[model samples]
Target: MAAKRPVDRPRPTLLIILAAALTLLTLQFRGLQPLDAFQQGVRDIVEPVRSLSDRLTDPVQTAWNGVFGFEALRLENERLEVELARMRGNALTSEADTELLNRLLSEVDIAYSDFDAVVVRILGQPPGNFSSHMIEVDKGTDDGIEEGMAVVTGAGLVGRLEQVDRSRSLVQLATHPDFRVGVRLVTSQDEGLAKGTGTEGILRIESGVRLDAQVDNDEVLVTSGGRSLFPGDIPVGKVLDPDSDADYRRSIIIGLAADLENLSFLKVVLPAEKPEGMR
Candidate 1:
């Protein structure tokens, strides 16, 4: 009578709770409206708290996603930047090619365009003003580019072949300090010599321009036929206003017709008997 009975465990309470959970799951699965209504009511009661909790956790989830995606995004940006630079380089190359094509087409209109020639690429050029100023061309005796032959572009005469090899030639640019060529004025028909003045890309006619000769700025000069290293009527340069003395005898300054610095492709004309013509 003194020993108490073992305390009864709440087995029925656990069984009741399990039964309720199973009943709720079965009713939800069976598409009963009452369970759904209860669910809705519960959701309505707790929705604000759920929303607040989600708001608090949303920034953390987004930060995790950004950290994981940043490397991929950076790689994609680098790829795009490389592609853009490549496109820009291609555009620049295309533009340069177009310019060369235009120059080749315009060469046909040069005064000595009828001369038999070879189209040669430049291999090298003088590095500075102090250098020999002789450019190397890809054509030589093999291509019939001989000594004293003219090297010209669409713009006009730029050089003459002096050092010839079997496969290549060295061209003495007209701007060279030792360069000299007989010249005749196009407008006045005054015969003169275009002599390099030892200055960079400058030529002067210190002797030929007569005091009485009517010469003005931008006067065209062509190679004089007789003893000139180049052919006659090959436009060499244009006169930029001359320097006059007391007797009005002038040292005519000539601006080179060809842009020597930009030579790419050029025509090496075989020397021929000088043609006679004047405007």
Candidate 2:
């Protein structure tokens, strides 16, 4: 007889698994005490591992959230800084504009009240040879400004309008070498011709008063309106010294009332016949 052939063992099947799971479920449903004890043992073995996994992941989740939050905060801070810079720039601009407006209004109210005058912006210094002695203004014939009109500031006379265009004018500052005005000493009976020296902050008074006249230091000078070049009583300057030099014995040095180097706004006094209006 040939050796008996070995029989193959059958593999476990899905039907067997289904039957086992159904039997456990039925026992638990019937409240079998032994099944409850087995379920409790499974939970006790798995619960600690589940809790350890949750604890490990919690810190990592928190760190990740913190990194993203830091980035968000950085972006928000940058946005706020940009907005603040823009607002600061706007505030500075508004303050500058308000200050300029107040200054212009004060010029109108205080200085040019005696005559119909045009308030003009000093555009800039004139170009080339005239730059040191003259400035350009933004109003001209169209604004009723004309050559020879007196230009002044709140402080006192600045110059006369030298040239006029349709919409612009040139001013010859009072310090020009060719400029001259009649002036009188406020404290003394001395009358003189106040003349520009073509130099900054200096004027020459060639008076007919005797050299021995008591013209003290800091004596005020005012326009005499002799030739009608300027109105009477406008403050010109205060005496600085009576030069005793051989060539300038009758002359004295004085400081100007108006600050020419920092001129900003001007008023052009209209001719006596021109009607009052603003540009």
Q: Which tens-of-lDDT digit does each residue in 203-239 have in candidate 1?
A: 8887776867888776667777676767777778778
TM-score of each: 0.55, 0.54
Q: Give the lowest summed-lDDT range of ten residues in model 2.
A: 104-113
Error of 2 at 119 (Å): 1.0
| lDDT string, candidate 2, 1-279, tens digits | 856546633345566878899999998899898886675466446545645865698798679868877887788789879979987879978687546534543443323356767899886765567477888887767777667778888767788888776666789888999888887776674788888899987888876656777887766666666576676666677788866543536878878878886577888876555546633
Give the Cα error of residue 145 in candidate 1, in Å.
Answer: 1.7
For model 2, what is the alpha-carbon lDDT of residue 50? 45
The residue ranges of model 2 lying beyond 4 angstroms of the native Cα positions read 1-113, 244-248, 271-279
Local error of candidate 2 at residue 207 (angstroms): 3.9
Which parts of model 1 have CA positions greater than 4 angstroms off?
1-110, 126-130, 245-249, 273-279
Backbone clashes, each candidate: 0, 0
- Report every candidate's CA lDDT: 0.73, 0.73
